[model samples]
Target: MASSLLIMQARLASSRLAQKALLPIYAGKPSLLYAMQGVYGVADAHVLACDVASFSSFEPIAQEAGFAIMAGDADDVLARFAHVAKEYKVDYVIRATADNLIVGQELVRLALDGAIDSDADYFCFEATAHGSGVEVIRRTVLLDAYANASSPFEREHVTPYIYGHPQRYKVIKPVVESRFFAPDLRSTLDTPEDYTRLVEFFTHRAFPSQTIIEEYIAWMRSNLYQMSL
Candidate 1:
């Protein structure tokens, strides 16, 4: 069995919602804590990847969650991921972002299993809620993209290069289950509006353990209904 590492990338510099990941969502917990907890135990190892400047901000939460911290390039996320994968010596990498508070663990497991079973360079769900998904990529595939990818967009968004060149990399996208398919739903914390809505959801509407996709969809539906009123 190949060893896999889950790397959740976080940073404190965002213009739309500055330091949104570190903002408290529930009682007193930062949103990163929730995101970290969401995908806690699915991989062989876990890492919190951030830029050198944001390491201090992220270290405490990462330590609390027992995730190894790696500081790397700020803009070139492909290089950051490659560095972490090489450092950990993992065969496969499960990619995540800190803004996605409800990136479902079950969905992550499914994607990881699909990547391992199909031996594909890349694997993700064909359709999923905006923030309730992850990407699984072979370490060699990531390294290849890091080495040969030249565009800023490819370098900044890791795995885009792999999916963009389907002929060069085997990309597997399994269809999501009907119940979990909600591509229109937005759950990422990116803007002030998103932050306010998430604060409300986490404070008043979430289950004790709120990472499950089914529960998230229910909560979001109820929240949206309330918002429209």
Candidate 2:
């Protein structure tokens, strides 16, 4: 079976922060560029699809970055996702958000690897609605999600209908061994403070290839000489 991933993303159209993706972190690069590079570091067979009303700005950026861009309905995200997944005929699907500047590659790969071992219908790293890291789905599971869910929440958001109604399918959450922590390390891009923290991290090292906690801890410990305080 062909294991593939599709990154569901769009430009900064959110009410919280306008044009967050295009916001510059450091080294004259946008947050979305770092995100794309981070994702590219982990999996190879993946594409980014952004729901822009017109192919005016983001299209060029995605094209230049070597990603396949598609203009589709912004509201009905599940329908868009289902259409793309079916067209690709992917056995496994990886769901990534553009806001996660501190997205974990090793964690994602680890979770995906574990999901394949179990009989779970859905694989996710975090369980809660706030910290939902990422999700991986078997084609069968995704098809079920699309087929069964048809509500306002599902239509606006992508996977909540399936995830919210857990009794319908078996969901998997993978584990990793680690120690040490901090009070808060901004992971996703939403407000200016989050962007500032990311800028602080990026100042140390431009577009790190490591996960959030690892990179933050490394920056704190000064283990990585390439990054400067």
Candidate 3:
């Protein structure tokens, strides 16, 4: 079995919602803790990758969730991932973002399994809900991006350089079940509106870390329907 690592990229700095990671989600737990919990056990190792400024603030949360912390460049997130990938010598990496609060272990496993079976350089689910998904990529492919990715967007987003150049890299997109294919639904926390929506929907609910992907989708769709009323 190829060694796999789940890297959750996070930072305290945000243009839209400041310190959103530290904001309470459910049961007074911050979003980062739940995000880390969501991907637990699916990978051989779990790590929280962030910048220097975020390391101190996130350390306690990461520790509480049993995730190792790695700090690097603030803007070059790809470099941070490369450093972690090389240090751990993992064969495959599951890329996750802290903003995606509803990411689940099932989806991570699916992406990892698909990547291994197809030998995909980059793998992701097609038309899946935004925040519930993660990207799986080969270690060599990620290193390639770290070494050659010149554009700031590519470095910041990570894996974009690989997926952007299909000719040079193999990209895989497996279609999800009809229920999981929710392109219009938005679950990511990038703004004040996003945070308010998340808090309103999840604060009174079950442990979001334990909530399955299906439930998240259902809630979002129902909320959207109610909003349309």
Residue 21 displacement in candidate 3 (angstroms): 0.6
lDDT for each candidate structure: 0.85, 0.64, 0.86
> What 10-residue stretch in candidate 3 is worst by lDDT?
220-229
**Residue 77: error of model 2 in Å?**
1.6
Whole-model lDDT, candidate 2?
Answer: 0.64
TM accuracy, model 3: 0.94
lDDT of 1 by residue, 1-229 (tens): 7889999999999998888988998878999988898888889999999999999989999998879999999999988998998888888999999999867678888888899999999999976777778999999899999999999999889988899999999998888888887777877889888888778777754533534677778887875732211
Q: Candidate 1 at residue 147, lDDT? A: 96
Name the better of 2 and 3 by lDDT: 3
* lDDT of each residue in 122-163, candidate 2, tens digit only: 777542222226677776677777788888787767778667
lDDT of 3 at 229: 10
Give the better candidate number (1 or 3) by lDDT: 3
What is the clash tally of candidate 2?
Answer: 0
Index of the highest-TM-score prediction: 3
